[model samples]
Target: MILETGVVVAVESDGLWVETIQKSACEVCVAEKGCGQKFLSKLAGKTVSIRVLRNKRSSEEFTVGQSVTIGIPEDIIVMASLLVYLLPIFTAIGGAWLFSDSDWQAVGGAFGGLLLGGLLVNLHSVRKRDDVRFNPVLMEEQIQPNILNFQH
Candidate 1:
């Protein structure tokens, strides 16, 4: 499981809306100062909002400001990435091979195959949008100093 820490922004009946900073590995690399990726990461916004499943037993105990860790399986991420990227590439190659006799025909076939592959991926994703395996779940809450304890 890959875990991430975020702050609960809102509490819903079925889940919590958590806001997390999106950090790239380059951010902490020793050579980050000279890496092009570091510059691109800066261009990308710092935060993202994700919905995490609320634990049924602790749902009522959660508050908006609470800090928590969310988790998703590593395999799910790998599978999603492959489906989005490799499918089109393989399909395009297959299409080109089918029309190999003519150069222009091969190019047109590859383009059509790429579009079809993308459409298939989109349809599959839409059908599985609510699959539990792809959803992130609340792992555990982090303890923070109670503001009520401070007296001024």
Candidate 2:
């Protein structure tokens, strides 16, 4: 599980609205210095919020303006990216090589494989869109006041 912190901006009977704080490392990477991402993050000022899963345990209760930390599975992100972008191209190349006959059959196989791969990738992504996990946690001593203004 990967842990990330956010501030609770709103409270509901079932869950809370946690505004995720965007960190500088997201844009400071040397490889992304000149990319469109840097410009976009700058324009947005680094915070986004959506409802989080309700805690089943009573100890996890959260109130408005409270700070919380959520645990998200890292594997989900990795698998999703791979499925969407790599699967199609890989299937196309592999199918083409395996079915090659110096004729149009090779072309047909390659196109079919690529199409199937892309379709599967998109379907998987949509199915797992709600898999993000959230939990409420107390802020550490020094950072409570700053979570709301840490945006850059």
Candidate 3:
């Protein structure tokens, strides 16, 4: 995951609004010290507002203008929870039933099954998202082009 720094622009009940700095890639091809794109970005500001998840330990490091590194996508939290809790619990029950001889043996079987399932699931998820990793995207502005320019 790409860890990014942004400024807190707004605070919502469940999340936070952050204006992240997006460096212009135009700099890569620019010949001069500064290009028109850079100038425009600077003029318009190199920031994009993005909504981020909030938690109880809400770090006070971020202020309206202060910079902070917030995690993007935020789905890892959910995925981890599923793997940690649901996977284990489900595996335990299933494993116990599959290898049921006594109560203690069933309990041990359940834990073992959960371990295998959790590991396999996590590995699969990691491989799946390897190319398209999770990241926060900014809201796009809608623009209408001049459609009157038609050649007959």
Candidate 4:
């Protein structure tokens, strides 16, 4: 399971809105000097708000501004990466192989397959948007410590 820390922003009937910053892993990665993830993450906008189900925590205790740790299964992340990255490449290769009789035909087929793959990805996303398996779960909550006042 992968964990992320976020702050509870609001309490709703169905879930709690937890807000998190878009932090890049490149900072601590050994390949930071050679990788483009840091640049891409910078271009990607910050401040993501996720709706965490209330099944794990109660509104009475999980108040706004309280820090919470959420977790997503590693398998989910791996599957998503494959679907997003490998699907299109495989589809294009298949199309090219199918139309290998002529160079022009193969090129056209590859482009068509890429488009089809992208459409499939979009359809899958729409269909699975509300899937509970894709949603992150609240693992732990942290309440801020109260400050002590000194006697005058």
Candidate 5:
């Protein structure tokens, strides 16, 4: 399981809104010889909030400003990454190769295949929208020191 610690910002009947501070090694890497990832990380936002679906089996919880752990299965993440990121790329290459008789045809085929891949992704998401396997599950209540994590 990939676990993340976040503070509950809001609570709803069916879910909780958790806020997390996004951090990366790039933000703290002071090595002068390092790449430009530090600059990129600075350009990106620092705080993110995500809604976590509540588990019915979970006991009644606390109020806002409380920290909690959320987790998702590693296999689900791997499969989702492949489907969301690689499917279009592979399909586009295949379409171009299959229509390689002419340059224009190949380009058109690639674009068409990309669109088809996107549609397939959309369909899959809709079909599995209600599946609990794809959603992040709320783990145990986390009570730790109130140490603020600011890497700015």
Candidate 6:
């Protein structure tokens, strides 16, 4: 499980809307001074809202401003990345191979295959939209320090 900490921004019947900072390792890397990733992160301000499925044990207990941890499975991330990135390349090669007789035909076939691969991926994502395996879920709440503890 990959876990991230976030603050609950809203409570809904089905889940909590959590807001987390969008951070990347590039921000803390020694080479950040010249990294294109750092520049892109700066261009994209660092906050994202995520809809997390409420924990079954505490589904109705969440409140806005509460700190919580959310988790997503590692396999889901890996599979999604593979489907989005490699599927097109593999399909394009297959397509070009199918039209190996002519260079122009191979090029056209490759483009068509890339498009078809992307479309298939999109369709698969839509079909799996509600699959629990791909959804992030609330894991645990963080305990906040009591402000009154410092009072005399």
For residues 1-152, what per-residue lDDT tens digits would candidate 5 score against the true structure? 87778887888876778887655344466773467555555677466797777777342454677677887688988899999999998888888988999999999889988988888999998887557788777875544433453225
Q: How accurate locally, in lDDT, is each candidate?
A: 0.76, 0.64, 0.60, 0.76, 0.74, 0.77
Candidate 6 pairs with clashing backbones: none
Across 1-152, the per-residue lDDT of candidate 6 in tens digits comes to: 87777787888776778888756456568987776776775788677798887656465566677777788789988999999999988889989989888999999989988998999899998887656787788775543323433347
Q: C-alpha displacement of 131 in model 2, angstroms?
A: 6.0
Give the backbone clash total of model 3: 1
- What TM-score against the true fold does each predicted structure earn? 0.68, 0.49, 0.37, 0.64, 0.69, 0.68
- Summarize candidate 3's per-residue lDDT along 95-143 as a digit string, tens digits: 9998899988997898898887788777866665423343343222211
Q: What is the lDDT of residue 1 in candidate 1?
A: 84
Worst 10 residues of 5 by lDDT: 142-151
Model 2: per-residue lDDT, tens digit, 1-152? 55567877877665567888666456457867666666676788678785665544332455567677765556754765677789999999877887799658788889988998888887875675444332333333323443444547
- Per-residue error (Å), model 6, residue 52: 3.0
Q: What is candidate 6's CA lDDT for residue 131? A: 67
Error of 1 at 120 (Å): 1.9
Q: Over 4 Å off in model 6, which ranges?
A: 7-17, 24-44, 55-67, 141-152
Candidate 4 accuracy as lDDT: 0.76
Residue-wise C-alpha lDDT for candidate 1, range 30-147, written one tens digit per residue:
9877777656657785677898776563666677777777887889889989999999988898888888889999999899889988998999887775566777876755434325
In candidate 2, stretches whose alpha carbon ends up further than 4 angstroms from where it belongs are 1-28, 44-52, 55-69, 102-104, 123-152
Order the candidates by lDDT, highest first — what do you get?
6, 1, 4, 5, 2, 3
* lDDT score of residue 17 within candidate 4: 90
Query: What local lDDT score does residue 106 receive in model 4, on the 0 to 100 scale?
Result: 99
Model 4, TM vs. native:
0.64
Clashing pairs in 3: 92-110
Q: What lDDT does candidate 1 reach at residue 90?
A: 89
Candidate 4 vs candidate 6, TM-score winner: 6
Candidate that beats the other on lDDT, 2 or 3, i.e. the better one = 2
